[model samples]
Target chain A: MTPAEDYELPAGPGRNDNWQGVTPRQAFMRGMAVALTVPGIILFASAAGYGALARDAGFSLGNSVFMMGVFFALPAQVVLLDQIARGGSLMAGTLAVTLTGMRLLPMSVLLMPLLKGKRATRWRYLVAGHFIAVTAWMEGWRRLPLVPSELRMDHFIGIGTGLVLATLAGTWAGFELAGSVPHVVEAVLLLLTPIYFLLSLIASASGEADRLAIVLGGFLGPPLYVAFPGFDLLLAGIIGGSIARFVVRSRGTG
Target chain B: MTSSLHEVTQAAGAASGTLPTGLTLALILTVISLATHEPWRWLGLILGRNIDVDSELFRWVRAVSTALVAALVTRLVVFPAGALGGVPLLVRVLAMLCGLGVYLLFGRRISFGVVTAAVVLVAGQSIMGP
Candidate 1:
């Protein structure tokens, strides 16, 4: 076997639950099935909320659909929609979206190494990287250790595709239902995005760094938004994350 | 002449649509992913995987990602935009706490927590009448 393939194999005895004998088709199916679970549901709800908000902000249904398919990230899409609705210039909107997307940088860096096995070509990695949003990143982080390296990319792509399709459908549905839906129901739908994150933050935390960052960021986010409304998310994340990392490192846990 | 000029400017402003902005934002999101993700993966490939995965730099990268997402989530909760902002501050915080309580109590199943929070918000608004 090639060195890369050997490296891709899981160390020691493999878990019976790991995708040892699974084919690529099975891996993709596994990914798609995961989308029906909590992670996929949260993404769908958020995208639907984005769609409703976009429609309310005067975007055409097509535009709302396009945003979900293209931008994909809800926070960035929210910024873009809000800015456009408020009559901001294109340059300002673009900058805001780009800043929100900066969060993806770390996600990309983390997922890149995990996805690269013997079968990964340069193009394959790049394409797979497109699918590495919060849900994909967290799921991959949790699941990649168990997957055969050859199936990692396939599994990721399947989940990513499922996530994309879910978001798109949710957006379209929200756009359609925006006005007709009751205010309370609408409120519930819209609130799901934040609630999902909060719960995920508390539940998905796996390490000291994660817990510290979440606490620091949650504490700092409000004040920072009031102080620097435009760049608040970016500022809070960088500052809070840096502090958490430093603390972890100093304590020898990093 | 001044009245005519004002009318023309108003019409021009109304005619400007969000098409350009949507396309531009989409392009920017795509580019950000490509620029940030592609370079690192390629570098890892060239230099060998051990250095890339085991290094201190990658750890910091992950730490920052978690922080950013957490911060953004908090921002949405504390300083929500659009319709969510209409709910009173107390109500928002209480609802969030309710959801969080459920999340912790129920083994962190995200849907259960989110549902609890949403239910609280809707129920609170109904009882409180806003």
Candidate 2:
């Protein structure tokens, strides 16, 4: 086996409940299936909310859809949308989006290594990488480890494609249905993504170290925001994770 | 982009004066927009090229990512932005806590917990009013 394929997640011996015998076809289908579930519904709803908001902000349908297609990160899009809606210049919108997008750096860094397989080329990553937004990333984070090396790319592509389609449809609906859907309902839809992502993170944590990091990060996240506004996520990760690693090592538990 | 060559040239002259036409401008903007978020992925791929998945560094990366995501989710619930901002802080926090409580108490069913939280949030909002 090639070195990249030779590597495996450190699962305990006799861990049998993995995605064994999962062919690339099955993986892709399963990925699509995942996107049709609750998480996917939440994502679609939130995208609808974004679509309504952008429309109300006087963004053209083309501009809103194009933004969804490219700048898949919602937080950056939200900042830019809000900024522009308030009469901020493009440069100012750029600044806001850029600052909020810093969290994606770590996200990309973390997923890049995990997604690289023996046959996976840079082009595949370049195309699929754009779909590494919050919902897709969160779902991928929970599910990717179960995927085999060869099927990983296809599986992720399936999920990303389904999600993109869902979001695009949502944008159209919200843009068109902006008036009919109660403003309150659209706002409520926006709350689901964060809550869902949080629960998934807790659910999918693999071990003690991950759990510890989650605890520390959760405890420190709000307080740290006061100390450093935009950089809190990065700092919480570095400090909370480093401390978790050190603690786990010294205790001989990891 | 579909504009004629003459119009493209004129626009390019008006805008960049030296840079290529709309295509180059579009490419630059795409890169800048992606740069806000994608560098870490590229950097991670480069650095992780040689790193063992089972090593301490891998564990650290996983931990860091988990921490980062956890923090982000927490921040969203606590210091929410956009729509969630309309709801009172107390309601949001209580709803999150309720969800966390259910996730822990009920066989780790994330869906159940989230449903509970959503119901709580909506109930809290309506009862309390956004």
Model 2 chain A worst lDDT window (10 residues):
A1-10
Candidate 1 chain A: worst-modelled 10 consecutive residues by lDDT:
A1-10
Fnat for the candidates in order: 0.40, 0.42
Candidate 2, residues A48-145: lDDT per residue as tens digits? 76677666555667777767777776656655554444333456456545544544444555566568786578877876677776567666666677
After the best TM-score superposition of candidate 2, give how far the Cα of residue A225 lies from its true spot, in angstroms. 2.5
Give all candidate RMSDs, comma-separated: 7.6, 10.0
DockQ of 1: 0.29
lDDT for predicted candidate 2 compared with the true structure = 0.65
**lDDT per residue, candidate 1, B4-76, as tens digits?**
2123323435777433445664565456434443344344434443454445665565556566667767766
Q: How would you class the docking of model 2? A: incorrect
* Top of the candidates by TM-score: 1
lDDT of 1 by residue, A1-254 (tens): 01111111223453435665788888888877767876788788878877776765666777778767665667667656655554445455555455456445555656767787776887777667667566776777666767888888888888888888999999998878776877666666667767776565555454788689888888887788678655665667678878988998899985
Candidate No. with top lDDT: 1
Local accuracy by lDDT, each model? 0.66, 0.65
Cα lDDT of model 2 by residue, B1-130, tens digit: 1222223334444554442224553454466576665554455455544545557876787687667667766766676544556677788888888888987787666667767787888888888864
